[model samples]
Target: MTNMLVYFLGFLLLVFGRCRTSLGQYSSDQCSWKGSGLTHEGHTRDVEQVYLRCSQGSLEWLYPTGAIIVNLRPNTFSPAASRLSVCVKPAPESSGTNVYLDLNGWLRPLLREHEQAAGLVRCFGILEGALFIEAIPRADISRRVTAFQYELVSDELTGDRPSPAEACHLCNEDQLLLAVCTKDFVARGTVTSVREDTKENRTSINVDIHRLYRQKTQVFVPGGPRARRWSGSITMPRECALKVSDDDILFTGTLRFGEARMGCATRYGDFLRWYRRAQRLGTNPCHLDTD
Candidate 1:
């Protein structure tokens, strides 16, 4: 596998060397880019460049041919740009292409054509440079599309992604306070279900939210038993072992690749006690509606 990857990298380098000087097309907007590969049929070595300057967006390449370098950047310039991470989730039907992170001339493979079919989300730092999408040569390109959604995630509150051992790290008081203020979603809920996704190596945590203090992008929708309250599922590392809790738990997490990911969470009762203490000391990072 290593030898094959190295050889492929060398091949891409040779192709990119010739295509680098060629003029490329840019997306119409900062959000999404859609293009067809038929244009590159006669010029098989043509490399198109696409720049998506948005926090989130999608890319679709119908009948993908040649190659495309997708440059993803945030719309706004802020200190958070340094902390920004990029995540891409391929469309389940995405095929006929291999994705790689191109840092200068170096190439790091992100997804193979078969792996993209699984539609798992992959993330990397913004400094990783643009995505190099190379189309596999085929005699017939029928119904094939290389499509994926991208999101720029700021790790302001999420110190590290909840992966493997990082997910098991308990948040300190300071981090906990920041999570409440900065996380994408916050709610008080009961753990209704816990399912393990062995393939993804992550666990799904369904929460029956009683009080959704705040949420971005309607992650929690009105559901569960008479449509009384909001409910949603959050993903976390299986190693975290977030079991079903009878007590109302304060759930705080972020949305990545359009999925909620678990962050700092504790029993609502425990949070209430800690919050009251911090309030008394006037050391709370931000204010929240306790009522």
Candidate 2:
């Protein structure tokens, strides 16, 4: 399957060239773009250009009539740029457009209007190309909008797993070490409860955090008893079989679509043992206070 995708991408290069688009009236902040299709009211085939330079942002188009090409270029350069990916989650009400990965002039369908309304997420490597969102032609364009939130994700954190079962697998020691430093949130906590959402095929775990080591986002809030401790929830695939436990566990995960995702988790005692061992060997990737 991957080979097929690679072959297709290669085929796209045969016809790859710049797309001709007319400028449309819109407002952008380099991180996000909001525009109206009414700008192309009479020009049904108009294609607008949109560029975003942040690691994450959003786009909203009202009264769709034409198309827009979104160019995503994060504000930094690194050797790991090739390992970056863009993940977009459409708003539940998003409609009237088909999203595509545009490699110059070639287009690969990524999502349809119906799929967008389902609020599904689609991800592609940064090298795949730009997003081309084309509105579906219709006589009535009222009450239609194409909207979604996008984020730049690291392949290491996502594991790039092809299957749900693999996505739930525990990371090895090396990955665990990197996860501690790269994951959005790392905390020591006890699982208070676990809830399963059959509709979403996910499990949400409620935690009472004893220590907040680091967090990229405000996933955990200070609460419980004079606001001394933090409390939050971490989401994981139901297939992982996570259960509420009294054991103190080290939680590390990334944030996706405003939710924390489980990554590498181990009992506090186990982490302390391995961390102490690594410390003695002078191979600890990063320092952490186990006490």
Model 1, 120-236: lDDT tens digits are 778888887789999999988887899999888875432334546566788877788889999999998899889999988879988899888898888889986445788889998
Instruction: Please give, for residues 53-160, the per-residue lDDT of candidate 2 as tens digits.
Output: 888989999998779999887878677876889999999999999999999789999999988987778888888889999999899899999999999998654322
Off by over 4 Å in 1: 1-22, 156-163
Q: Would you list the clashing residue pairs of candidate 2?
A: none
Displacement of the residue 257 alpha carbon in candidate 2, Å: 2.5
- Runs of candidate 2 with Cα error greater than 4 angstroms are 1-20, 24-28, 157-161, 225-227
TM-scores for the candidates: 0.87, 0.88
Evaluate candidate 2 by giving its C-alpha RMSD to the native, one decimal.
9.3
Q: RMSD for each model, in Å, please?
A: 7.8, 9.3
Candidate 2: what lDDT?
0.83
